[model samples]
Target: MKAIYHILNLCSFDVTNKCLIAEVWCPVNDLAALRGALEQGSRKSGANIPSFVNRIPSNGTPPTLLRTNKFTSGFQNIVDAYGVGSYREVNPAPYTVVTFPFLFAVMFGDLGHGVIMVLFALWMVLCEKDPKVKRNRNEVWRLFFEGRYMILMMGLFSIYTGLIYNECFSKPLNIFSSGWSVRAMFTELQWTNETLSTNSLLTLDPNVTGVFNGPYPFGIDPIWNMASNRLTFLNSYKMKMSVILGVLHMTFGVVLGVFNHLHFRQKFNLYLVFLPELLFLLCLFGYLGFMILYKWLAFSVRDSRTAPSVLVHFINMFLMKGSGEPALYPGQMVVQVLLLMIALLSVPVLLLGNPIYLYWLHHGARNQGTYRGYERVQRGSVEDLSVTLSQDMEEGFALGDVLLHQAIHTIEYCLGCISNSASYLRLWALSLAHAQLSEVLWDMVMRLGFRGDTGVGAVLLALVFSLFAVLTVSILLLMEGLSAFLHALRLHWVEFQNKFYSGTGIKFIPFSFSLLQSGLDQDVLIGEV
Candidate 1:
């Protein structure tokens, strides 16, 4: 029936001969299987079947067929949501598999929340096998079932990040906290302050004399959670971490372009386009990133004269113009000069190289046509073919037009590189919001729940516990989960994918029995079943 439908679409009637003629396009590799099927059908029908197969010359773009299995299907769906890749272009799905979940985890980290997500994903996976569930009327349930594996992986990655953050439901674990306590050391020092607050008790540095033997080896020392300046400490740490991760993620995206250019065999593009883009990014934002790290590591709290905020130093670099004067450091003047020169040089190379290259290419092809005469042109020489094919594909490229397009592209990339790097900071922003919201919920409701034991007090405590749980699930799990999901998606589509993906391919639609069956009357199938 599938074959018959395809034939019907292209069938031509031969009235005198009482026959039909048809044409069909099939993959070269599938020709043998198609022939075998035709022969079997002819034998079963007891009719003489005649057919001829010829190789078709490549004339246009072919449909893109993405090969994927159970493990990769979810990631492929994410890729398709942006746009399917062009024929023979590199598929971004494979790269997205690890990146999507990792980014989501960065924003959604919390062991308790991750555990909840994992349980939900597991339930969806289990429910997928049930026929009743497969036919579920709820769209939300259907979506969950479809992306169960993705959710599971995301939950697992969140758990890993959560562990690194030492956060479980906005509370730090006390597993190693007991051994690092400074209460014994304070007593030894004859510091008889009896009413030391939890914050004071926890913030004690182990490095101080006669304190604990060593610091906590794992995640953030749990003590940081209870410190007087906990919020300030976390804010500083998270903001700087965001910048670092942003730089690294964008750098990875730029590096991936190398593989894409190599795959497409466009070495000129690799050198002229991506290399300059990479250099500009590194020299500008990359240098600032190094300063950020240096500030964190070497900036002294006691010596205010030597340490200045990175943000101020960056501004001063641009605002303070002088006769080769070093405003921020002893030798920053030379580094800045070299970086500025390279950045300026790269701009013209990106804007002019492709147009120049194309001009020579087209000029050489025309000369070849003149020398070879009309006979060579009629025979379709390789040079003519190359020029004609490129012209057709690009709708007749001209030098001026190419130059303008290249200029626009270079400008977009240069600006986008700056904007996209800042965009990844959402990872830190959302994570901070989640943590703060969690803390608020705990203080508002859970604290009340823990306070009382008597009849009326117990009843009030129960109500508080109920309210806390409800708020946690609704606000933190459902609301924040969706928010983090969107941010993660934006990072992939705008920042990561823009680096390499062309996403202009037509998706492959194969002729299959299942497609034919689906098109059949549903009522008939129901009656038969």
Candidate 2:
């Protein structure tokens, strides 16, 4: 037995098909002779294997060749950039998608509609193997099957946000307007015998039993009321929250950019890249934080006193901002100035600090590599190699990459924001659709004015109409939901993915499935065969 270690090293080879060339790295340390035999066999089989060689990294000797290929050359481009700290060779795509649930819920939130989406997404997962749907099956099936947990979680989030917005299928609830009604709705949910009906039915009788137990003095009724007939606060608030979150999301993009720059040995560029984003986030967060406190408590506690006045200071702090008007006093002005200064300076400090640290790390690493490279270059060994440097390369940002990046980000953000928002709209659209359809069903039952005097013909007609209404609503739920699901994924792939990800990295392929071989297998794919 031979003691050997295995490591994955990429190699490129031309296979039979031009459109599907194979490039893979394999481990074959113990199979050195097998690799040699394979290479000889491949040549005899008329397999194309390009040569890639380096002067053997041993004592001074004439340039010795090791087998590699044109495809390996491309793989080297990716690896070398990673080694030098280029755009993270591997994109953090999965992480970006993780935030989708939060984004969608903020935009389209309603428990009933979310349930509908969950069911539809589930349907996609179950029917993933259908031949007719295969073309449309990729991302939808990928998310439903591979990322099912995330889909469910996002649906639940939309439900939670809908609860906060009191928004369902456009059947809005003004929880803030009537505190007692809000309490009653929740109290009913707490009990097992909750009836979703209008307020007029409950008010028909003074009997408490009518409210819960017996056939009411009147009939079932809707207790909650919608404030607006047109635009609701729930929908407006959802959009505002989306905008705020979108701003935060973009800031995160810039911060990631800075980190990537640091990784790629571009220390100076890190601060320059991060400055704009940090400033944007500081302003956005500061504004949002102030608004949240003001809306809830009508409070703005600025530290006015130079010294702590103990209990009095604590009480007065909350009292100051509660006035609901801008302070004109000199003391309040001074406090505001100080706060603004601290917040403004935060951006510069954060932006500059990371780059300085990165610069130090880059220099330290460069010093070590240069020492080794310099030693070889000075000894006149490196110059003697037959290595040729190419200088005819076209430089500067390519129009194609810029256009690709910008076009992708623009579409992704727009569709992403709109569709995510629309998802919440389903809370209104579908839920309202549900409620309205339910109302139509009830109307059919009520229109006959059946005072226990109806014949069999009238009775049969009402039953048929009510059943038809129920079927119609069910179809609407499924149709609208499936549409939303498709739109949601479009935003994910085209809009969101384009922002930080690109179709650039070569997928990792193992060496066991090789069509051809090269002499370099001894040094590259030596341990894993």
Candidate 3:
């Protein structure tokens, strides 16, 4: 009904007083098809003459129409949920096809759990063509069915991350055998029974040859399973990785913005605004990312423990505090100070660059008596010119609003670098929480089944196993999946899109017989052909 009314609103009474006339806005490629359809409709209606069509040039921005088929539709809809893409703007949906699932998998990774998700989506995908299933208009089922592809992709990505984490049902798989050796500590160090008994825990020395050969061929070393400091190791790892990924993702968004500038031919924005913004982000956080990789590669196991913290180094760079820790490299002071100065300089440029340029451009126009385009006024006297300048400046471009908007924008980007970097920590937080909860479920419920033996014990084991299954599916898979999906959506919508997406355009709604046929419910409700 809304669609019908919207189309009706675009029509007007014809001068002939016997026909209604309507103007259509469609792509140039569709013009011939549209004319053919009009002629066919006129003949079918038994009109005296065929309908006429004309093309007129329009400079106004047309409604944005992004062509999408079944496989891409779901991903495109995910982007539209945030905001419709502007006409000619690069669609984030293309990239979201992969990033969305990958980020969700980061939070919800679990091989066994992902297998369950995969199977569920696969069932829906296979049954998608069934008429009976299609006719079943349960709205919730329809929503899930529509996104079967997205679900499948997320599940598959989860499997990959889970493999990397080497976790399934909260248990480490010992496929490559353990890397660390307690025996090496005792044998190589010549430790006697007395020495072994005195120590509560033995450390794996990476410096020694036999103690630690290398990383577990894949994923984490299963030997970490036996270590008391596993959480310490895992926490540091996941947190740093979250920052690394977050920085890269945001940088990509800023880089994407360059394309928008090029498309619009707004080189003023390209040089003054975007370049400075990009420089600012890279100097501060991009430098942080570089430091992360540098520290990982530079500090070998020999100095890993003694190596200075990246997080502390960053904080100290800002505070200009004492370098109490050992320098990671020589003459670090000069480089750190230079990068900080460059980052700080980018701030003023971001705050005032475009707005000031606009002000100057408009000011030049007003002084030249060419304000608001080529309506040049002859100013015979200085006093008259002064009056015109004051009026033009007041009416044409208000510098105050531009400054305010730019100030807020500049502050948001700068502070967001801090807060958003912290926001990515949720990736580590949820992943750890999911791992811990799943481990608890296994330890408390599933583990008991393995200890059972007798007839009664077997029965008890069966009951416990059933309970484990229910909890795993309901809490971990379903609930945690929802949580991860929402977080990933937030990351893309807020953190990713805000950097590049303007999203100020309205979506295109084309008139078509196919649409009317598909919208059977709306047609029936209207009760008219």
Candidate 4:
């Protein structure tokens, strides 16, 4: 139909009957407008004219068209980058509006950097609104403007994460510093009480007491800033946080499959595929995660050795024949075994359930004489069922093919669950890199610049500051930002969206006056106008 419309010049008019006919496509929403325009045209022409619009059935796929506003346009672009959703399919852009920035901020969290981002986004938005700038703006600037809202959200989320991390410009805040004094507490070691830095005194340890009792209330304690084993502390915290967040994010994706299943009316798929997938994730990773958090909370750092390491325990559980010495606590071993068994059993159900059900459907259809071998079904009430039968036949519904496809899907999901979970460690890795890099910059450039006040020293300071600023912009803002963006994109596209999104839709390109004019102009040129 689209092809015929595209080559409409080839359509002939029946001059002998004094009638002209042509097909036109318009949006379903604008059917009334189209009818009104035809009526207006008939009246203007002062002749009795008639037109008819017929609803044509489509066997082929319909184009995807997303309705979006300024806020959602950036998210729509991100969704498009993965793949457009098919017509009437679930659109991922609305979800991406929140998830994409939240994920990005998880990796890019830093109070100072987030603030800088917010300011930059604000500037871009302001520039976009300025008449002079808007008039002269290049594509690059326009692109930035288009994504200003996304940037603002990203920056806002970064600030939230940064607050949770208790870091600003790679430095911990000292708001709670007055609660403790290091030298005073350590006076028994014959240390000078007056000289120790305020940060060095504060402690995250709940056992410690001075002006205040227990650990510093929020986000890493100020003492970690000056802790001898800061990297170890930060790495442990960041890695654990990443794992927890990853599990939650992926589980959320799995939960979304329920909606997709319901929307597509695939009840068998919902029960067979989504339920098993969710159960597998929860049983293995989710139970393991719970054990990890329990270990962290229940056991003191010094007594950590008393508990089995989650990672080592997982490996040993699978590899070791019998648990000679129990790695899990009390009845946890039994629970672990049960969960493992359930997870294993789910694989076959996930693999075979759908194919078998589909085969049964086809078999029943054949029995009903509704479907005939190698025969094309006519369009009518049974059109959908006929189409399905035809497609199944065309694809060759051999048992071997079904088994192979199901096996592949099962393997992919099994492997993907592991890989996708691990992929989230990039959040920890990137955060560590950003923090370390920020520290290095401060130590190498800013530290030196703060050393002196003389003429030569001032000159040296200015030069080093300039160099540091350039490096900061290049490495932190551009390079790291781009890297985080790509990783976040991957997390959403492959890990998150893969669970629910089909991403098989064609983009909608509606017929318009401009297109019509262009076609007419091309026809004229073809006629040597």
Top-lDDT candidate index: 3
lDDT to native, each model: 0.73, 0.42, 0.81, 0.74
Model 4 per-residue lDDT tens digits across residues 255-353: 876765665555667777888889888888887678778878877745665766677777655663445444556766667778889989999898888
Off by over 4 Å in 2: 1-92, 120-154, 166-232, 284-289, 299-529
- Best candidate, TM-score-wise? 3
RMSD of 2: 14.7
TM-score of decoy 2: 0.44
Candidate 3 backbone collisions, by pair: none
- For residues 319-385, what per-residue lDDT tens digits would candidate 1 score against the true structure? 5443432244567667766776787788888778777766655666555763221111111110112
lDDT digits (tens) for residues 1-529 of candidate 2: 0111122222233455432222323333424654576677777778665322222243322221122343233223322333221123234333434555555564455555677667755675566577665455567454345444445656777667656545455445543343234334345444323343433233222132223332222211123343332235334433444444544554454455554445444444444334533453444343443443334344222232232222232233434342344433336534544544554564455434443433333345445764111121111210111111121122322334433433444344434433443333333443344445534544555444454555875776677667654554464344544444444444444433333333333333334434124424543444322
lDDT of 3 by residue, 231-311 (tens): 999999899899999999898998988887766555567877788888888888888988888899999878788999897
The candidate, 2 or 3, that scores higher on TM-score is 3
RMSD of 3: 6.1
lDDT winner between 1 and 3, please give it. 3
Error of model 4, residue 315, in angstroms:
1.7
Clash count per candidate: 1, 27, 0, 0
lDDT of 4: 0.74
How big is the positional error of residue 309 in model 2, measured in Å on the Cα after superposition?
32
